[model samples]
Target: MYVAVKGGERAIDNAHAWLAEERRGDLAVPELTTAQIREQMTLAVNRVMAEGSLYDPDLAALAIKQARGDLIEAIFLIRAYRTTLPRFGSSLPVDTGAMACDRRISATFKDLPGGQVLGPTFDYTHRLLDFMLAADGDVPAAPEMPVDPAPVPHVMSFLNSEGLIAQETCDGTPAPDLTRAPLELPAARALRLQALTRGDEGFVLGMAYSTQRGYARNHAFVGELRIGTVPVEMEIPELGISIEIGEITLTECETVNQFTGSKTEPAQFTRGYGLVFGQTERKAISMALVDRALRWEELGEDDQGAPAQDAEFVLYHCDNIQATGFLEHIKLPHYVDFQSELELVRKLRRDATGQGAE
Candidate 1:
């Protein structure tokens, strides 16, 4: 006989109440403000904004606080909130060439225009935790250096001029939005890039690492990695002029991959591109590598049956929210299902022992 439990509604209510209390932690300790999280836990807020496809830092911080620092849950909350907002006219494509770059680096060139700017990177920092951060301490601002005012040219543009890399052709067609339509087979490059940008960071990082570990090796070189603020503009139909709407921080990565051309084409270097919201360099670079790995068919290269090479596998499994929902749903009521299997097993055992009694 199977037993069923009731009073799930009350139990759920009490659990939520307890969770709210736990979220606040000790009553004696000061409650963390949203501004504090926005400024101090900037990377977390940035990740939430990037994955959620929203750009409001304050709202992202609030979501983080409400989620108790669960980044995916914060992203989910932001996504849910975004669905309720009214739509505005789309802005013109941002001119990244005019970007006021704070961090600009090119791994392919030793020296270039605007030079290499190692701005606000954790790359050189020691992994040791600073104990001073635990206690309240007055922090002094670091001295600033004069930044190059001239626009920095893209590294890939130089290669393109020399006819050494694949040419980026523009068809002027509006890319399909995956949010509005169902995902179809043979996704376009734009759609694939959008998915990779919003996909789980850890999952994308693993896929990119797998490619580097001889699974569809593309011999990728970091052509450039730039992080900075770019002005957003919207063309006013009434005024017939474009004006700056606002500014947003972004991270862009371009990978140069070795291409041995097929019989139909000549050998040249190829490119993989990634642009993401906020200063998420790791995510952007990983996204670019994975993007290139998925382009094997378009590049006329043979698929090595690698995990990164499987577009369907990467797209389907990259969503953290969907994966979490399915995994957590196992805890739901399944007594009837297990009872059926139990009866079947008992019946089979009884039949084997020559006992036909029910």
Candidate 2:
């Protein structure tokens, strides 16, 4: 119950002015450009793009700048701006197998088809902070290898051919658009994937960690993880042909879990899939774990009463925008509601003490 307070127009205006001044910071220091955020703060920009459900790096960089590095606020700005854009026709599904991979590795097999290409990763880097970067260090360029034109096959394909892993099949059913439609319960795998892809990274990571901590553990192993650029194509109505629209970098993860078998079906390894915009491997891996956890019913496994296994709970709370909106609204003025509660408590105390009404 919010009561309108109409006397703070000037205060609100001045507050906004102060916010703008603070966003600019000290005038002596060189102002950070959006390009710097896009390049230097690449991880932050990628996170914004992934959770905001928009892939425009420039807009994401600008939002980060405008929000003063508050990533959630930047995501809020992106989501709000996304609503106002006109809807173009949907593009065809990208072919991950045809991706021009920068990084590709397999935990299941070291000697896979494409071999391991550790393009750019922090896996081998020491975590010590370098003061040289603070003093504007000039880094030497990384050595480059000639681009491979051969198509990189998916690691899961090998297991599939050997009938060791569960095979995924498409029923030709169109996937639901969670943006246009409100999220409904008993969501299909496609809808859940949509929500998880744009879901809060922290929340998803926590949930996935819980699984590894023995809550609904599926004995998961990373089959393959790849980060690469894939071409996006859209069909033209007039021409009746698909044309390449653009390319976007993505991180894809495929996890193999414990085998499931029944009296009717042979035991085959289960799979968990994750795909996210940009090079967000952590989020992608987390998404895969949670995705598998939610599939307990589909996999004919007993529910372990875990938070990750509860679809309603996971889907409802995973959205950072919705969670933040509800949580932040309590900070708004609630004087009238508070006063009413105060009076009620006072009257109750007075009655308990046998005092006359005042």
- Model 2 C-alpha lDDT per residue in residues 1-358, reported as the tens digit of each score: 8776686788888889999999999999999999999998988999999999999999999999999999999999999999999997899999999999999988998898878888788889999999989999999898778878677999999898899987788898999998888899889999999999999999999999999899997679999999999999999999989999999999999999986698777998999989999989999999999999999998788998999999999999999999999999999999988999999998899998889454
65-170: candidate 1 lDDT, tens digit per residue: 9999999999999988988988778889987887788899989997888889999999999989888778777777979788776778888888988899988776
For model 2 the local lDDT of residue 112 reads 83
User: Model 2 — which ten-residue stretch has the worst lDDT?
Assistant: 1-10
lDDT of 2: 0.92
Q: Which pairs clash in the backbone of model 2?
A: none
Best by lDDT: 2
Per-candidate TM-scores read: 0.95, 0.97
Q: What CA RMSD would you report for each candidate?
A: 2.1, 1.3
